[model samples]
Target chain A: MGETVIALAGNPNVGKSTVFNGLTGMKQHTGNWAGKTVANASGHFKSGKRSYTLVDIPGTYSLTAHSPEEEIARNFICFDKPDGVVVVCDATCLERNMNLVLQTLEITENVVVCINLMDEAKKKGIDINLALISERLGVPVVGTHARKKKSLAALVDAIDGLPHGKEVCRTDYPREIEEAVKIIEKKIPEDCEVSRRWLALRLLDGDLSFKSEIFEREGKALNHLQIRRAVSEAKMYLDKSGIPAENVGKIIASRLVEKAHEICDGAVTGETGYYKTDRRIDKIMTGRITAFPVMLLMLAAIFWLTVKGANYPSQLLSDFLFGLQDDLSGILTKLNAPSWLHDCIVFGVYRVLAWVISVMLPPMAIFFPLFTLLEDSGFLPRIAYNLDRPFSLCNACGKQALTMCMGFGCNAVGVTGCRIIDSPRERLLAVLTNSLVPCNGKFPTLILLISIFFAGSLFSSLTSALILTAVIVMGVLATFFATKLLSETLLKGKSSSFILELPPYRRPQLAKTLVRSVFDRTLFVLGRAAAVAAPAGLVIWLAANITVGGATLLQHCSDFLDPFAKLMGLDGVILTAFILGFPANEIVLPIILMAYGAMGTLPDLGSTAEIGTALAANGWTKATAVCVILFSLMHFPCSTTLITVKKETGSLKYTLVAAILPTLMGIIACVIAAEVMRVTGFC
Target chain B: MNEYISLNQIKKGEAVTAVRVSGSSSTVRRLTDMGLVENSIIECVGRSPTGDPAAYLISGAVIAIRSADAQNIKVRRRENG
Candidate 1:
């Protein structure tokens, strides 16, 4: 049997990916769309002896080409001409979704309307008349609770039946639109594969479809002037009908909406009044009085939980990994390996790898799932809704709030999430400022610094947690300021307005969120950090072990940096450690510990007293701790984030800015902090 | 009495009928495409914590619109007789 290509299309936040995942199972490849930052995922499935390749297009509200995602989705359906298209709709909000479905129908007849989220709809007492909708639209309607595998079988069956399905019912437009479309339709070339009526409607609606895009696949040059003249004539004809040329698009959109309403009149019934639960929750969550405080408390709570949960596991992992070094050394002694090789491999390479995993993994494993829970519960959009004004004030996208939240888990992931912002200028602002939020890797260092220097005697853990939150709050404020400055100077642009949809709050799928965050986020970030840390560990080992003149290479480098580091309230050893820790932030403190010769390997700071004694021995004061913490919060991103920023921006210049901008900030901040502490005699 | 006003002027929990959606082409296209066409009923259900962009119940979807954008969407208050 011949293979079939199916395009999955839908409105944003509708469970299109759910249905795609249900059908394709685990056979999927996710990559950026050709020459576009937008991510595309494609997979294959088998139905009744036929292999089907499913392309999951980005979720878009319309095919009007107002945004890249919408354009990509529209281009795939119109130009690619897939064998079947599954138009997924949110069952709870079928009316709004019908606009996209109607648009898809105008392009291809081999389409199926898959009403997803049927479980949510059923729970809300919304009954959808699938057969009635199918009859009305003249396409197969498959009701699916896409999350449940069993419920998707009918949807798969509908796709299988697409080859034998009835003729697609074209949406009837208003009289003025129909007359203008007829004029434009006569001008479209006869050999075009896209539906003539769709092309005519697009031309009338002032679509920006380039002539090259129209016939690029056919290797033919289209008569661009002919199409433009035909479109203008259509608009002129509609203008004579009293609808202005500028308003033609609205009129066409209204006609399709009117048709959607007509179809929904009898096909959708039941108590749609049960949004009361979501409303009741939103009342507190987004209420002006409670929102800010609640947001702060939530941030602190997640951080505190991560700190508490990761402490023991990180210690155990470190102990276990370091303990393996002794046994390996014992085996090496029997094998008579060179002393330098043993030391380099075990102490330098293996130890740093272990330290990164032990320190970075536990926090990320805890933080990412907590973050995903907020996302799955639909609270992240509310955060965007609340912060939209502030972001607008900074001339950035409100969606930056979502990306910033992702940054808290890892800045690299946050940089990737910047793709959601439509405007390139705003996205660049987001990408550059994303590193201001301290990620999971930096948490270990911050927590250590705070607990050792700032934790008060009374309620130490709570005090440390509050101080940590304050530092994060400071980082967020800095992000806003930096974004403002960048917008004003480097990347000037008006703030783009967006419709932030606060999706209906549902019970978060805890199990799926955990598995997804663990593998997709936590493990992915850990793997990247480990890959960089291994080579870094070897370098750190070589520097420490290799002798230069009378002193070791590490000692010589630290000696060279001493004066500058001293001016910044740090010493030569600490500055050299920070520079060497560039590959991953998780190894910074461990590097410092190793350089201090406090321990031959990364030491778990058992208590604030032990950490304080070590720092004190190195000429550290409260001022030094303050400067280090500030510097740690503001410094250049780790190697992984820099690579991600480079990949995302695709420019060496911006990547350099991403690295240098924060480093400059960190240096200035440290200098000021150190000077203030010195003048105040606090040191 | 039906009084024409911008959508931003509508009070929380106040239901209105969309009279006309006029703004930047993209904004207008987006609003109308989301089923906020003429005579379609919309309700201001909630407001953000900072209280600029309010959530409106439109076509069974909760869409958050900033006050600036909301000002462009003219609506008429639906008074219960």
Candidate 2:
């Protein structure tokens, strides 16, 4: 026999995901806020002799299908026909969570109510009478602190004892609607797999613009002639009463909300006192006077930590990796491997792969965890809340700010995160402008340039970090500018409405978040960079080594791009390096160093000052460094982001637009900077 | 009779009971789904700097509703607060 399939359902911010992870032993990113798990995640777990397939449906407020996520949650519960459903509810706020619970009960009798976050509830001085509620709802209810595995044992036990015949205490609809529901239920086919009561509610519900969709989903079961006649008859009966036609959906919703609160009267008790602690923190974090400064300081602190924390580890890693190249070369020589093969393998592929890992790993390891910490603590939603007004001024949804934050990690991720924006036009706008702000992959190069030219020797790291923060601010402003431009011209539309939920600030699970984020985001991005870097290193090496007439192919290409590069206050070698860094941004600096090395005038690379001196010898000016930073900031996204864009939008045209928009911006910005420097005699 | 006011008109730290949520737009539907039904208590907890979206405490959750959508929701001040 197949495994017992159980659908895990709940309202937003209810720890439904936490429960899923506890049961399935899956690392389904438990970021505790609304809409994090938009796409359903399915995993398997075992209990005693029985195995269960658990589908974690998106957290939603209702089954009424007001949005895509809700629609998904609704359709899954109705049509999927799982063996049993485990509705996870937030114990601290069961009243709101019950809205989804009673609606689910209306559909299925095989429900095991898992009252999750018992710890949070207990902390809030809220108490729930689980046994009483279980009896009231005619379902087995288990209380659990989802983070504690022992607490989840009761939940697993309840899943094994899947309750049947839920004599659920649901609110009765008003008499007119009740009469209408009865008529519809009487006409619904008994052989129908769908619950008769649920189907009746849908059939009698007003203005179901997606009625055909539900009917189509149920495979014509509710589309029968008798059901239609009964529904219209019920509507006539509703009209005969004082209940207006349009008021049907509203009235039905009101009953459920009332019923949910009523059910909680004896079962759940205690006020969180308007979450006083969280409210106090929100006053400062999202306060009108302090919000922007707090935001900038938070961003700056994270970057400062990332920059400071990553330096030693990065240096050590590169030293170890690059130090091994000579041994590899010596081993190749002893094995009588061809010089070209040895150079390609040791000096080319191995060196690049090593550089990518050493450079990308530490910063990502530091940055992603801090970012995840913010995400876990509910601060990110507040950021979206605070920024919504400004973002809306661009004619884009404020959620774009969330996606932009994701972009600070990686543009590919930013593009995927664009899924949170509902409107196609705004999502497209986000996708197109995402690469304007550099990802962590671009940070190594940006930092190197800043330290060399902008930051004076004293407090260099601090100065560079602050300058990096300013550069990020520049990128953010550019994002707003570009979004506004596109919204006006290409992707014009009114901003779609989204309910921004500022979830109560829970203490972030610090240790757990750090460890999981390292595995989830840091290593994943590093793995991709390493994959791209090795092959790219080999290609760049070949381009530099392979001679064309008098000069190497690398030199020839640079010479060809030299004049245009100068127009941007950069030289040929820098331009060629940017072009070669197409596969991954991590290798751009290494490529520049390698090109300079080929000229035989570059010094051995180690310290920043020594490298700066080498750059000066190679005709690099402060203006050149500034231009390089500008170009790097605004240039086309890596090939990975482009492919992601293509896959996301399913349009080659937009993918090209994503690439061209930033590159054009970079060229214009660099040329203007270069011209201004020349005119001002600053170059 | 307690006078009805648009939700945004309620100042910060004020609590009100929802009388009726008008309109059939997706926003109103979302508001209803999130437990802004008639007689449900909503507290004005905070406001954005630009004064467009005001965050309300409803059903044990902080939900930010823009003034445009807040106008659809009619409420009366709660004496308790």
Candidate 3:
């Protein structure tokens, strides 16, 4: 009555989220699913006089409750009772997509089949007769190019017209199954709202969820014992007919496939011959001997481009911004402005912005676009394929490796990506171990430490990059080891089988990749860092300038945290900054600068050696630097990650574990590093 | 002869039927969800470019079950093969 509730459901990478964002603009959280962290999304839109709420259900292949996403999707549709459901399907893969559509039809028939990416289908020379599909399915089927909003108006009109539409005749399953379903229909209680045919099919397939649900709904009158007896009777009858429960599903699927093929026989046509390019390329890319090397080379190229291309721009931006700050300070002094205003503007705002732009922005700008390019090119799936075995060896889902790889970009995003792991236990394992992968934020700390200490005497800046790469490799190794250890111990479970579809390599749309990377990832990071950095800058300025008992506020806080920091192989200042940096990692460096500034003035990045000198002056040794870097790499996630974890798990206990586990690991690693250094006299 | 067939050794187009699932619950659930059951038909789609394990098409979805997981799952070659 108030607003139309429209649920969007589809398989992964079917552009459901893209469709949601296209409809709602850039005002939606495109993270993991709410509560379950299963990649569910919901957004709102207004069309004409009616407001519509679109719930993006997790992308699932079927409604058989194979994974958490599938279960959540099935439950939401059945229980939540939405007004209308939009089932988005891939236009190019209609046969496979119809499996889900047919399953949805078995449930409530208040549905619209939206065949999206018609343009891609067209490019592949595949044509669809929407009329025939509608006729076969007995539902409204709208063909759309969701990315371009093509036929979006038609979709809106369809939604509005749903209430007035006639009851379309639904498709029928096999006659034998249909007959069995009819008999079962009469046995089910009249008050049960779910379609009898659907329940019959589920029962025939031995679907545990349906059996449990029916048992629970029936309560004491039909207990589990009775339910099990009934199921066994049904199984006996089914087996006597020479058809097993599992065979029923296969028969149904194959029948649907046959129908889909019949409908598509003449409706669609494509090039009969395979492309030489695909074969030629696949020969090398999928080659047994060359694949690993090629993958490594490709990854190295991407990282090299990111690091090399980012340096000059990063330096330039820092100089320009910091120079503007000095000019603004002089102008304010000339205007006889208050010292507080000067400190807030110059030291607080400018310094923080400088650090953000100089450190966070450039790498992100270079990295995200390249990452997007690889993703668009369909290369990331190969990375998952490559790492699958190693992951399986650790008794974890192969998809966990993919999630960890994503964490190298951002932990929150990585944690969100764990939705791909179908098993609840494996998904949780992936989420917990994600923090072990150092993100872009941690890269700056790694680079600085490695550059100053490890690569200072022996090699050039290139060697510094290599050392940084080695650190990343180490972090990945840690992630694998941690995942293995956790899967074998704390969260013991069998790993889920994941089918990583290595999509055909295509030329990535540079424009789309660039825009999305810049807007979605780069700007998102910049905006969050800037928001926290400004206030943090102000706080740090006040702490530094406002001294208490001849000791700054920072010093007091650091002194308080000193004992714990020492035990963990770090000093008070470093530990205090890490604590304060819980909100955003970009703020950690700025906070450290402020802490040092409280003690004595330090020069900017113009003279790199000056920063090293200042650190040495402040009693920081190579051992301390190494400890700080390791701690930064392994420490608890920022506020964003914690919030994501809470949202994903929907349990304070799980969120606390996600937070504390990493922090504990970080502390232990730092302690070991410090003690080893101390005993070896490396400091 | 009870010759073992690891998933890694499965060639493209080879058909096998699952006899049992011998993995952890998570792995078992995942495999079962992928339509792997006591008697599900599976055809090896292809090997990874590196060939450590093969990709198989089962129940319409493509899954890369590792050699270890595959070794645990006993399979009899389809009679047609």
> Individual DockQ of the candidates?
0.72, 0.66, 0.29
Give residue A77's error in model 1 in angstroms.
3.0
Which stretches in model 1 have alpha-carbon errors above 4 Å? A1-3, A27-38, A209-212, A215-221, A456-460, A598-613, A650-652
Q: Model 1: which residue pairs collide?
A: none
The CAPRI class of candidate 2 is medium
Which pairs in model 3 have colliding backbones?
Answer: A33-A39, A33-A40, A286-B49, A494-B27
The residue-level lDDT of candidate 1 at A237 comes to: 84
lDDT tens digits by residue: candidate 2, A73-161:
77888888888999998887788888888988888888998998889889889999998888888889899998888899988888888
TM-score of 3: 0.82
Alpha carbon lDDT of residue A350, candidate 1? 81
Deviation of model 1 at B34, angstroms: 2.1
Instruction: Provide the fnat value for model 1, as a fraction from 0 to 1.
Output: 0.73
TM-score of each predicted structure versus truth:
0.93, 0.93, 0.82
Model 1, span A312-387: residue lDDT tens: 7877886787678789888888899998878777777787787777767777788888877876677788888889
Error of 1 at A174 (Å): 2.3
Q: List, in the given order, the native-contact fraction of each candidate.
A: 0.73, 0.56, 0.30
TM-score of only chain B in every candidate structure:
0.91, 0.92, 0.84
